[model samples]
Target: MSEQSTTDSIVSFVLENKLKTILYTWAAGITGSLAYEWSRPIPGSLKIIHSRVYAQAITLAALGSVAAVEMYQATHHPDKVKKVDKHGY
Candidate 1:
């Protein structure tokens, strides 16, 4: 209800949106590579298995890193986040 609390809430919303945009942009960059590999035909069962395993490992690693960094920032320096004003100008 206080002025500072309202400001903080607005800031948090903006920061969350910004982080989502960044993550989505990163995902878009990877989508083409993923689509190409996914469209390919694997010659053997072993190769298919290896590809799936590798993809899973890589996705997990990347997500884990992003989560870790987000957690660290949220816990240690949330105040560093920026909030955009409501005007669309």
Candidate 2:
């Protein structure tokens, strides 16, 4: 039996859990951006906490939109999804 390499395993995982991977990636990007912004010197009287909250809200909204689109596709075009499931893209 041939064993899959680490790269192959990681690729398979990402492909199989595409939505989850996307969410994680999106969240990571948001967090990184926020971290960078925070690292900069704070402007006098500016509220960083509000900005963080807004960023989180935006991320959640974007995630919800993606999930809704995915659901719509799965329901409206199930055959296409099935084909992908049977044969990896």
Candidate 3:
């Protein structure tokens, strides 16, 4: 088999780390929020269930639930995630 290239190795390393994956999306969300603040709303886009305030609330709730799940798994099934030395230097 051919050896993995440097780009492939870096992508695999990042994807294998779960916390880094989630935190990366959170970084993207910050950029998207900044864009939303500067952009005007589209015409005729408002709906009873799809307004900006409602959407933001739902997104926040989803993030909170995911965080809860991560905490629960880390506490009860640490082996399910990558093992790391918390205090190794």
- Candidate 1, residues 1-89, lDDT tens digits: the string is 45656645544554566456445545654564455556777655555565566565656665665566556657767787344478821
User: In model 2, how large is the Cα lDDT of residue 25?
Assistant: 61
Off by over 4 Å in 2: 42-82, 85-89
Write candidate 3's Cα lDDT for 1-89 as tens digits: 99988854644454355456556555555456545644645443443223445446545754665566656656765776555597721
Q: For residues 1-89, write the lDDT of model 2, one tens digit per residue.
A: 99988855664565467678667766675677566667678862343564566567766765676566556557765654445554544
Over 4 Å off in model 1, which ranges? 1-43, 81-89
Estimate the TM-score of every prediction. Answer: 0.41, 0.47, 0.39
Candidate 1: 10-residue stretch with minimal lDDT? 7-16
Which 10 consecutive residues of model 2 have the lowest summed lDDT?
44-53
Candidate achieving the largest lDDT: 2
Rank all candidate structures by their lDDT, best first, as comma-separated numbers: 2, 1, 3
The Cα local distance difference test for each model comes to 0.57, 0.62, 0.54
